[model samples]
Target: MSGQQPGRAGNPQVFQPLAADDPTTVAGYRLAAKLGAGGMGKVYLSYTPGGRPVAIKVIRPEFGEDPEFRRRFAQEVQSAQRVQGLFTAPVIDADTDGAQPWLATAYVPGPSLADAVVAHGALPVEAVLLLIAGMAEALHVIHGAGIVHRDLKPSNVLLAADGPRVIDFGIAYAADATSLTGSGVTIGTPSFMAPEQAAGRKVTPATDIFALGQVAAYAATGTPAFGEGTSHGVLYRIVHEQPDLSGVPERLTELVTRCLAKDPEARPTIAEVIRLCQTANAETVLRRPEDWLPSSVAADITVRAAAPAPVQTPPPPAAAPAVAYSPTAPVAPATPPPGFGPPQQQPVQPPVQRPGTPVPPAQQPPRPYPAPPAHAHAYAPTPFPAHQHQQQHPQPYPGAPVPPKSGGKRGVFIALAAAVIFTVAGSATAYVLQKDDGQQKQGSGGSAQGAEQGKGNDTTAAGGAAAGSAKPNAKADPKPADFKAINLTAGYHLTLGDDDVRPQQGEDGGYELSYDTGGYLDAETSEGNLVLLDPGQEGSLAVCRAETRFAKNIYLTKLAKGRQICVSTGTGHMGLVTVQGFSPEGSPSEYMTLDVTVWRNAVGTGSGSRS
Candidate 1:
């Protein structure tokens, strides 16, 4: 909100200092202050190594592990790099493989066309003509690269001192890939949608042109070509009705009309639109010496440009942690609230400590796993209660089956039968023998009696039998990772797919694994990265790669069978984890029983597609 006057400095409401939690530097560039924040990540004003200002966007941490999101993000970023147009914000640098990926673009210091429309009702006929030509030129470059902007609207167009700059083209699908969207489903902003896009039909370069028509009409009429309403109603109008371009200027109406045609074939190409604009206003130039923006908007931009950049100092160099990880570190259950600790099929059973093994720290950073229902091992006709004070457990995991009691009863019967046979044989000997033989028979009979009597108080043998019967409980020893299968919910999944993370047993009967993101992930950023923690350094994503490569890759050491992988997400929480058996009828995530011990203040963000 700063403004400057002749012979005076600008006011001080232009920019503010960084927040307490904001990172000082990102991907080697020192940050000054925030530009904006969105669901994806925060945008900050940073400078390249050479000191020219840039707008850097840091993706939210949870997106790092989403396979689908990562695929889309990588494809879009690569496409963005190929675009070099006069009316577009050019991408300068990016780290698509980092834990929390980020990209930097040449900063365009201006308000969006949406803001301009809100402030000043409708632009003059000359301004509307200029807007069309500039956007067409931008689309020409974008379509030339075999990419579709998908969502093109007034909010995505910025009006700078020079001209309008089209921004945010990173959501389009890969030009060469097939669609992952469900049949008859559409993807885009509603009000500005093209008819074909709204109907879930195939889109082409002309799809953007249709949106271009709406943008131009809005700039001229100060409202949408399609009447405003709910998303469904708006979409219905786009597909079934003609555009109401009643308020667009007469001189530009014909061109806008052609762009808004229901059929893609009826739309004019970007090149043709530019030629018509040139014919309408031969003097139009992107770099017009005269101020082109509305008076109030131009004054605001002038004041903002005159303000000084926020002061920033370089962060201190940081030393790296240990170069190696201890595979022998004690294993534990993977906790779900903040981690996938150990599986909780039954009540949490304490792990018996073994001597001489170095135990990992008791606490670790939290993961995005959810805790299994309290009656995790039990099966019933009704759904398990999650918020109740007590839980009923009637069964254990099949992996730890309870042995039959009939076997113990059979052993006792066999022992008693042997004692009776010995007594009968001694009595027969007594009848057949004389005095000396009778004495031997008596001794034998006494021994038989002693053996039968011993059964009454055979506490030692009974104790052994009781221990044998408890073998079912003994099956509970394997840690979370020791389970055979794991599934995830729709909202939660690892970048490494099910096949990639399944521990493979080699010919040598040991887990054989390569430390990589199977076929889908980037080795540069994931080599040692743990999903439950922040990328150690923004300057370099490889800081924690060494520690997490094996974990991320699902390499199980003999020691890892019960290994406790402690995770630390930048969010304040610790995750204790163990994995076990899965339910038969639910999703992988739902049945993937994890023993999770969330620390005192675990966050609740992992249950959905985090941001």
Candidate 2:
């Protein structure tokens, strides 16, 4: 596959630097990176000498020389020129009769529908509806020009921050063009083809509707309507069998079923489809909110930067609640992050600094009492609400102990409960965290061990020793904490996708969230702030006690608009970071912010994700 991937360079890693064999420029535009390559030819990410981004598909040598293909290509280009729709990636420029036969379309910055579903499973019902409607609208425009988009499938549709866009009309034909599928040189996909197209019969606009049914089924159920198999079998099923809508939702079954009808006249027209979609979804929004994609798929939106563009503000510090411990204390009077162990020896001073010393980002120093090492098992005491007198550190002087109470039945009950609740006659302040869908299980990504496995090899800093180093005072491995969460929408949704929300640079040693692909969190630059971490290494997240580096595998997939993730500010305070939401239906406010709850001091709780 040599042709430029038309329009999308969603995966930043896939955008390879220009090769020696590649052209310095195409037509007049300068080629930046290779977008895609296939049987057709290489597609390059280019800039019009005017600096406009475009996916330029340069046809392969063999196809360009075919006399028959040349005529068909020229006519299709003319047909493509007549299409213009909010949902279609319009063909802005082309030269079908030129030496290489190239075409350019406006760039859509998110992953293709296929890539999104493959990486994150089925899209939500609302997302699928919007997709169907958008594609239907695009078809309305496509057919208006008398063009039949002969090659319509998931990959040809991109999930942009704005909406879905139809791309790659490589096999499209004018209403009167010759067949491109008959006589063995099939240009369209078999699983999604119309019966007429599969039987080498006349192709028409309804051909696209059939494919739309297949695409919708795939989007809603994460599988094709026609089962997967060899080319011959799939096409055979398309021509003579009933579609399997088993996984589709009930309301949509009727709609897609009609589109997949074997008889062209029986299929719904593009206009009818738009009307049906709007009627069925009268409550739906014509356009999706900015946080339209899951973080995993959003990470693949590489046409622009996808990282959060926050200013370089030093993350606030975590406040150490008032509490103190004595030498060789046991699990007695302290509240911890969860999964903490009782003290085994002399009181250990947590790494807390005076007001003048600089602190790291995304972290808070553990209370200045005996604490466990990164891997040490910890005993978490119940939250001790502030009010009762308690020491902030191991006190040099001892405190009084409460005598067992003796009274009547009612007073006896109170005495018994007080004995279980109090220790050394003290009360301490407790820190409260929000909880939502419990700790968001990480995203369904390439690997679950990415972060957990790394923690095993991570060096611990307790007792002034690195993770693997031996320290006589190193605390034993603390049991992981029960991560807390809350809906990101609790803080009214923040719409940062607008171009006006530019990113602010950081100050010395402050927290910074960066993205390899641009627009990650620069809502304007990248529809949202989504950073795709390097696949094999530790990522930069200011979790833990200030400037704690996060492991690669702990990231979540979908981040909703206006959601905030709170972590230890490494000071005595917690830092709350909010990422923009892009949910199509704008409900269930999922926060896509970097979730530090999963890794308080890199303990690695709830490290896996559900697909």
Candidate 3:
């Protein structure tokens, strides 16, 4: 977080200022404002003359002129540019060769995974699964490009509104980049680094996989595999000791252990990691888990600078058949290709010069049409048959398809349909091939085979603490004859019972519910029930009972012992379930921790269904 401060000396709001007033600007862009800064450098708010905001980071003076650092920086940028991913921050522009080297990309606003954890706590199992799968998918892409994100940890991950996004590629490299450190200098986090990394061995995709494992463990248990220790002690443990996974859920321990393995070759490949994560029943990780989403998939993220807040006009629904990029426009279109969306909304425009003003011809506008947004352009037409199009049209890529007047409409229809079909098929094929390639390199089946070869561990929580009692708030009325039947009206509806009551409300403004097993609800006494509640909030909430088969399969008595049963949403909100014990005579006793959960929600969705 320590870096050069740009503006005033003592104000928190006076961050580095960017050059936004002039078109031909500073930092290789029309600087707008300071975005954020870190230990290495300051990221500025800049834009193409066309008005696309790019997060531009200029190297500190200390490192910019260092020949070694510059060479490495150049190589790193090249490697980063080759990575294609939905969950990773992609390079939009950079100039490592400049006087003051800098790297720039699309600015994403969100809390880091580290911030999320520190602010909230451990995420629920489903959120952890999604995090793992998304990071794995990103790694698969980086690996495919012959690069590895050597520094893969929670601090470098952004939990954006859309999903998880891996950022900060300063330490990423090609598969064979020269080592950046001395023999004894460590390059990664001690708690999450692979054994090989700790041993100072060459890093690889497996190393990242191992780091991801530690990230997952931390996500589930609010702690890392190696726990707290001195750097040397942590390294030693990573190299020679076993991870203390007593607190980790049964379903996640195997994966985390494999990731912490001393032999890097033994770890699962990125694809294999995704497969296990996808196959694993995340429900067993937390009770009453939230729904999951693929955070790794690239989203059409549009971040605009707030000024008078210029309005963007979307492109026409259909464009006349033409080349994707026109000679007049070399900039990539903001919108994806046809079938993705209506024509893209172009980047914001600068003030127009008056008719009598002598504006430089170089600064002349390309096309009057505004471009579409990012997702709209992600699937943009790959350049068409360039030579053929040029030779046929001599004018614009569109008007060149000269029509025999009457047959014009039919010709355009056939061409447009072909373009849509081709784009769709190509995208699908690429996704499948990429997925397969990732699995092959990581040897995922080996771990699954190991899992199958090993005997399954008992996952039942010890002590029958299935019956729970209502703890009336200190402000509430005296204990009701039967809290369950008393309509304990406070501010919200409270549903409580062993019977499968349709999703109801709670005492708070949010939906509230509490249930117990009793003879009155013998029919509802099957293992567990799926309580799906749509609070008419942002999204619905779901709660699964402990008696359910999936819940029993992943919960461990050891993990639940003396601990409260809690589940979290992907958005990082957690709720605790009380654990009540029972005697042989059917008398319910005070609650003592022994409850288990299979699934929970992740962090950062809208408001909760239940408070």
Candidate 4:
């Protein structure tokens, strides 16, 4: 395996300096710098004792506290260690019993498929073919070890000089083990999920095949096959709509389509996918060319592979203060590190005085660490403040007299007198114009009704007609009443039928409510109809009346805050449920809170609506 050299110069863009809260060393290996962070943990660049570089992933402390997660994590690490192939990064070491579990993998110094595509557009057809073949081989090895990589996306694949390397098995699980869906959290990326995976059904090796199709399409084209939007919208399309493969090259279209089949049984296996790639290339063994990647992309990989400088820990303060630390105590201000953290405020200083003049009270000396210069690295050590470089003025001749002030007080008085005269003259002109306008109105009509008509005409001519016309309509369309906020949990059922709109626990089937994985809330009764509104649809009774189709389940995973959902109850009442917020992620007591507004009358009698 190729890796970065430990003694080379670093590129600030690739390797950020360690943060104040970041640890300098984990176990026996010394952390060189921060690589990046993800939802579950932070990845750091480190060197082995033999001077070969490795990437260490430290799991988040919250996840470490969960006993179930710890058990699953250890099992996954053991399985990942078994996966060995030419196109995969192998797990080198791990410690699952520590306070914070961490695993180390051989670091492949190259830009990810996602970053490369974003930086240099889509890859050529030849490059994409190689990518698919390499990824399919890696998946074969992973599945051979009885593991399923639940989260497979473009970001997890790295582009190496030799071939593509698949990395990051952080969420993989044994194929026969129980899933984590019981906790109401779906595990895979929304855009690349298979139909069964999006519906929270059984995920098999076929699930990764569906993701492989999406990845190939993305590599050939610059956008996702299902297109991009909210997670709810993307997942819905993946489950119900056909993928958009318009930009996919004609030669690879059929094979990619087969892998994306909605039915898992219909999709091809990993072995067959490899066969198709070989057939398309017309080679029993696809050999890579000397210039496999585009010139621009290869140049970018070369720049990122350059090793970064080792992080130097700042020395501790020479004399410590005697104050004890407390959680509630006000924190003393410290200078922010070079490139990251909030910007520091420069102190306000008094104006400079002449040498002969008495100085005002002197302010405290400037802070030892000054604000960083523009474009500094986020994690670099703070540099010393630059010396003041202001050029000094030559001293005046000893006997020379100071120049006299020019028009000091008299000029100010004249300007004020001129402004007063202009103000009086302007006010007189305005009074004459007002008097003339009144005379014209009186001459035109003497009756109050006629004068009012004349005023209306003038207002219309001045483009203020909408203001006069809009008031009555606004008054006629008053917002509906009976709005209530309901809190729903796993065992609760939210009833939108009567005046009272509250969630009840353990109701019968007619009024039952169940929350499932992928943000699905099921109201499994024959009485009411539910429809998730389209993006930007207004949340109102009228929208519910116009909705012709209703669903048994509503996916709220990607619904934006304040987005509306239309629903009709068994009691012939219509309502719009707005998502207020959800419980903190990974919380044991996970729940969703909704603000529902119900109307007494039901409108259209389409599919799910009650007459």
Best by TM-score: 2
**On a 0 to 100 scale, what is the lDDT of residue 382 in model 4?**
31
lDDT of candidate 2 vs native? 0.53
Query: Per-residue CA lDDT of candidate 3, range 1-611, in tens?
Result: 01112222112332245455322344546555674554456666555555544566676565665677778777778878887688887887777777776777765544456655665677877777778877777777777766667777777776554467777654533212333233343335567777877776887778888888888988888787788779889888888888888888888777787777778788887767766776675432322111242222111111111311112444679865684544333332232211122322221221233434553433332222223335433444343443233234332333454434423434344333433343333323232222222322243333232223223422111000100011111111111111111221112222232123232333222232222221111112122222211111111123321111222111222222122333332222223332223222222431222222222221211122211
Q: To one decimal, what is the Cα RMSD in angstroms of model 2 from the true structure?
A: 22.3
Q: What tens-digit string does per-residue lDDT give for candidate 2 at 1-611?
A: 01224333234355666778988677776676776675456777765554446777887666777777778777777777778788888788888788888888775666778767876799877777778988998888887877777878887888876688887664445212333334444445677888898788988888889999899999999888988998999989888889888889876777888888898889998877776676666753455555556656665654333322211335689776576431224344433332222322222222323444453431222222222345432332332321121213212222322223312232323323333332221111100111111222434321222223225433212211111121123223223322223222222222222222222332122322222122232212111122332211233223322333332111334333333443432212222344443333545542333332222232222222100
Rank list by lDDT: 4, 2, 1, 3
TM-scores vs. true structure, each candidate = 0.46, 0.50, 0.43, 0.48
C-alpha RMSD by candidate, in order: 27.2, 22.3, 27.4, 27.7
Tell how far residue 397 is off in model 2, in angstroms: 89
lDDT of 1 by residue, 1-611 (tens): 00001111122343446789899888778777676654356677766665456777776675655667777778778878889998888888888788777888876666667766676677887777777888888888888766788778776777766677887674535211324333333335688989988887998999999999999888888889998988899999999998897777778888888899999999998887887776667544433323566777665555544433534674788765464222122122222331222222222221222334433432211111123355642221121122111122211332233234313333233323332332332322222222111122334343343243335444423322222222111111111222223342222233221223432222211112122222211112222223322111111112221223233323222111122333333332323334332334433433233343333222222221010
Candidate 4 regions with alpha-carbon error over 4 angstroms: 1-12, 170-187, 309-611
Q: lDDT per residue, candidate 4, 153-206, as tens digits?
A: 887888877688887654544211333334544435689888987897998888
Alpha carbon deviation, residue 130, candidate 1 (Å) = 1.3
Off by over 4 Å in 3: 1-26, 30-35, 170-187, 282-611
Q: Each model's number of backbone clashes?
A: 42, 77, 43, 2
The 10-residue segment with the lowest total lDDT in model 2? 427-436
Estimate the TM-score for candidate 4: 0.48
Worst 10 residues of 1 by lDDT: 1-10
Q: What lDDT is obtained when candidate 3 is compared to the true structure?
A: 0.47
After TM-score superposition, what is the CA distance of residue 271 in candidate 4 from its true location, in Å? Answer: 1.7
